[model samples]
Target chain A: MADTPPLLKTITIIGPGLIGSSILRRARQTGTLAQKLIAADCQEAVLHRVTALNIADETTTDLIAAAAQSDLVILCIPTGAIRAVAATILPHMKPGSILSDVASVRSSLGPEIHALLPEGVSYIPAHPMAGTEYSGPDAGFATLFEDRWTLLIPPPGTAPEAIALMEAFWHRCGARTRQMTDQYHDQVCAIVSHLPHLLAFTICNTADRLSADLQTDVLEYAASGFRDFTRIAASDPIMWRDIFLTNKDVLLATFKRFEEDAHRMVKAIQEDDSEAIMQNLQRGRHIRRGLMPEPQN
Target chain B: MADTPPLLKTITIIGPGLIGSSILRRARQTGTLAQKLIAADCQEAVLHRVTALNIADETTTDLIAAAAQSDLVILCIPTGAIRAVAATILPHMKPGSILSDVASVRSSLGPEIHALLPEGVSYIPAHPMAGTEYSGPDAGFATLFEDRWTLLIPPPGTAPEAIALMEAFWHRCGARTRQMTDQYHDQVCAIVSHLPHLLAFTICNTADRLSADLQTDVLEYAASGFRDFTRIAASDPIMWRDIFLTNKDVLLATFKRFEEDAHRMVKAIQEDDSEAIMQNLQRGRHIRRGLMPEPQN
Candidate 1:
């Protein structure tokens, strides 16, 4: 890679949490940024952690001040907090700055954030469908985005150049960016990420109270496939709670589909239909074969 | 480590398939046998794979004669096939040789297999909780058992020394052994292994006809946790069919519990109860945290 070009203008991150700090780390590492890298977080601990990683060149505890001095302000926070933070930071934004966010539950906040943004400031919504079970600045790594897809939910009328620049940035961050409608993004995520998390969380909680002997045996025999679900269910509780709360409708829809499908199998088993059992098992095999290659950890 | 003592004495293997061949591979690697090592399969091709892997010094189509010549005759076949195989092999077994069978669904098979054994042959049931999505001799590897658990189930009046010897052999083959009653083994596995496989199979199968665009999204987002399920669902269909067929009652019971749990959560989401959702997710986190210290793979 060639040396990074000097900053044309500064980029300010609204919350230098895990994904936020990691984005800074990757931007600098990939030589995509031309000027300054600044981070603004309400928590001093977050500032310290980001600075300690040397991913940010400057830091502050004020979102407005950070927005006033930047060409781009990236909101990287919880789904529940995106709207309030955007409202606070919107007034202080300079004209022509491209403001964007990295939140998973896009549809819930997209319109609200769009409504609050000052004229001439772009609200380009993006969600990187990539993460590990860990969180926080210390847990973030430059390579988290490698080979993962970042869905960009740019509002219908957002300028082409603003969307293109964001796509270029994601590409440099090592993620393949796919432009998507806000509705499509939300529904797809509900099936692919949200509902799966709910299932993992539900099963884990249920199995936890079984006899100690059975519990140990459950974990031991988990090599059969349950262990993978266990790994996801192990993710930070608060982040997931916020996700389930915010993406309620889409997740509920997917869960309904899952329940109907689960019931059919249960009925088949009760009746001892070997053909039904074999058909279901074979179908699972095909999907397993169809799912894309996973990134080697 | 000291050189292996070649403790095996006329070891015999019945139904020399994937697990059989794998056990043979690692057993030879550790030099665990005291004398001759023999493997037999009703299928000529299976015996050929055994000889090619060199786990068998000799192979035969006659399972009974193979049983008569050995100190230990391992029934390395499906959960459903063990009883029939044992019925034929036990009749020709020589007195005093310990017999053990490797079948994942233990509780249901234990009594049946024990009843069929010859008067003098000691019967110890065992299941090595290790395998890949792949099967057959080409998939066999000596390291498959490395850091894996091999569970042993012994009937009443079985000599302790006989169990100890087999345990030691598995340890040498790079596996840890756990002794448990047949009933408990089946109950634990129904939730941890069987239910998970059925679930994975169903999810994969139902989503197979997903639109091209949805399919792409599924693959792209799989690293979020879905691919692990895919790998499990990819396991041999024939073997899984045998497991569900033989362990119908236990699996039915397990499926009921899973449905009750899944249905409760689906209702919680439909009702939009934050408290219920949060509780389930947090419980999942707790259970998953407990599983972290164990060897997941």
Candidate 2:
């Protein structure tokens, strides 16, 4: 049997942060993602750390130069910075080359980036549905994407071959891949990821605003539920800030839905309506249980 | 050196559910909580399970009989049913015997239960800040209370000796005990436990109410944030319902605070106020990081 060739000749990953570094580590370990892996970040400190880690064939602050030499360039920056960074690097990307990103939100990103895409370069945005509260290059691991989903959201009129290659690329990095339009992606992500994060962040502030004594006690006696919320709340502020602003419409709609449901719960409790409260609680529990994977014998 | 006597000569646990069975298991394992451990439940099946598990010295379905022979009787039932069960068993409790409960809510319970207290019988209510999403006798373990807080809320003018003995009892069960007023306990719990559970339950229902396709995708791609909320939402519905209704005022107040904070977040995102969003996210991250225990070498 003939050996399968490497996925790409050279791939440059911009912004070597948590997700970027994890992908680089995975590519270096597998030795099949690309023959040459380039790590590019505007920050000298990040490049220094990338060099020290030795996960990339080359580390550079010159994203344009790296883009000019690569068959694929994945932007691992914040959602707010994707367009500006794409515009700066797209002109140098070769024709038929692929440009993708790992931004969490995808509301207007598709059309905005498509407007800036070079004539023959393909832009296929992807979101790897895996992360931790911790960030930065030092916090990444090779298997961070294992068994996780990487949703592909390509703009309209993009080449099918580019999307297929990106899917195969993510699969090689140990992630399941699915393709969906940007609108659906934002809506699903709003309920599943964005809204939960907003609630986590808001609840932490609420707890922090309590009286000094109560706040101290709340921290000292933080229960499992509160601790879980706090752990989610500890994610990177700038990254989350960008996500919230980019997916504002869907996120706000979801929050309104959650708020109405919460008010219903409050009314049930206030009216001493045990049956209504029980029904709502049961529905929540049932829905949650249904989401669980079946246990294997 | 003399051997230390048991905390109680005979102690009965009603309900024999998660917390109750855990206490029984710990008592059986340590042989110091009580000289004779009795498990009583209205359901014969629960008592049968307790017997089968061999965590209790005696198992019975007769609450009155169990109370009549015990020096200490702890009601490990739902908050809404605590008063009625205490009223039923209080009449049969021996004189000078201590009666306590492990209800999650404390609002108005201290006064109400104190009103039904027979002469010379003490009532102390405690809220153990340890539990899982699971319930029932089969979902318990001996070390469930280890290093967890059990806040004791005794009625005004209660005997100090009774309070001391109950505190010691919980200590032997491997829980740290603290005494506080019912009002304070309710307030602390509203933020630390009840409010978080309320949010978790409400968010699950909100996601359930989404469009069919979106709902399916939300569950299929449930990320860490949503999964955490679901884990919390999967808790016993009946137990949570009773807690919400019992602590109605405090829980509702906390929910209001949380709603206001959430609205503020929505406004920040709507106005595209990155500074405000960044500040709130940073505050949440800072508060959450502060709650983490220091790393030991």
Candidate 3:
């Protein structure tokens, strides 16, 4: 068998929070990136955690300085902050360096990032579909990416070598990599990720808004399946807000479909149409089969 | 302490499916039902599974005969079927035996159950806030209720001795039992379990109805929060359909609140209101903390 190729000569991760730290840890452990693993974070405590994890060879608050020293730069902060970080650091990076990111939605980011990429730098956009409700460096563990899928959404004219390098990095980090068009990726994520978060968060709030008497009962009776929503609803707020605002069109499109289906179920219940309600419920079981992470038998 | 009083002199479980068998397994392992533990199901295969698991002293297809022999009788079938079983077995049950059920909903049931109770018998309603999406006798396990809550909702005039025996049964099964009115149990579950299932089924159908082109992409993007909904959506159909139909008013009431929240979020996104969006997202974390299962830590 042919030997696997190294991901990069050196790696630089910007804003070493949960997502960034995972990439750094996995890359170093798998020897995916040779020479050095570098990271930059504005917050000192988070950086301290990242350094303690030893995923980064060096840490700096200066994005530009870090950008200059590494061959692969990963933008890992919230979506709203990516453009600002790019503006500050891109010019300091070497010309051939590859820039990728861990944004949830890709199309919403085009304008800000396009205007700031250093001339000649290859920007292969990525969204690693993995994370927990927790955040910061301490929230990360090496297995976060195990068996997860990561999409590398590259601009059409990007060189093969740059795409190859980014794909290799994600593969070593325990992700199954797939390439997708930016528009398709955003639309797909809207239905899958964005809508789920919005629904979970909104539903949890609806329960909490009930009278104090009802609130305690709601929590106690949460056995009716509200427990799962609580877990998803707990995800990072600043990050999700930016995701909703940025992916507005696609999210709205998916939410429209969700509301329509729910309205029908409500109608069926009101009319007491056992057949319709039963069919809808049964079909859910079939659809859910496709969605579960296959558990070990 | 006085030698632990036996929770059951003889216990009868009708309908040994997933929930039924789970209760039996827990009862036998915990020695909750002291003298005898019996089970009845239509399917002989299910009977054998129960016998093999040894959660039952004997298994039969005769509901009335089984009820005739027990000190405590539990109707462990789905809701729509529970009323029929109650009617058939109530007349034959021992006169002073306490009758109860593990149905997820209660208010809609009290009137029917109260009227059907055979003379000189007590009817108590209870629900264990626990289950897996999986079903069938083979799916039964002893620890399903380990940290879940079991709410016992009986009419105001219920005999304390009867309530105590039922509570002891659940407690021995490893559940923390709380008492509530039938109306309160119905309302809380509607918001937490029924509404969420409605949302899951609706969203799953909506996503499934997406044009053939986007369906594969939807599953591809399934790793994002979408997987959570898929898990809930995959639950048993007959059970959920009854939930929606039986708990319609409360589910509808809760739906209005959820609809408003969804509208606000979509509007915030369309208008690009970062402040409104973040505030809404932040509310989820608050609910998540309160919703954690108390003994999990």
- Which candidate number maximizes lDDT? 2
Residue pairs in collision within model 2: none
lDDT of 1: 0.77
Work out the TM-score per prediction.
0.93, 0.96, 0.94
Please count the clashing residue pairs in each candidate, in the order shown: 9, 0, 1
Model 2 DockQ reads 0.73
Question: What digit string (tens of lDDT, one per residue) describes model 2 on residues B102-200?
Answer: 998887878988998889999988778999988889888999999999999999999999999989988888899999999999999999999999999
Q: Which stretches of candidate 1 lie over 4 Å from their true place?
A: A4-8, A292-297, B293-297
List model 2 lDDT by residue over A137-249, tens digit each. Answer: 88788899999999999998999999999999999889999999999999999989999999999999999899989999999899999999999999989999999988989
Report the lDDT tens digits of candidate 3 across residue range A1-297: 125556567778887777888777776666745568888888887778877778778888887888887788899999888878777778888988987788988765665576677777888888888998878876777778888889888877788988897887777778899998878888888888898899999998887788899888787667646888888888889899888887888889888878888888888989999998887776666666665654322
- Order of the predicted models by TM-score, top scorer first: 2, 3, 1
Among the numbered candidates, top DockQ falls to: 2
Instruction: Determine which window of 10 residues in candidate 1 chain A has minimal summed lDDT.
Output: A288-297
Q: DockQ, per-model, please?
A: 0.61, 0.73, 0.68
Q: Please state the error at residue A114 of candidate 2 in Å.
A: 1.9
- Model 2 scores a C-alpha lDDT of 0.90
The fnat of each candidate, in order, is: 0.72, 0.81, 0.82
Task: Please give the range of 10 consecutive residues that has the lowest summed lDDT in model 3 chain A.
Answer: A288-297
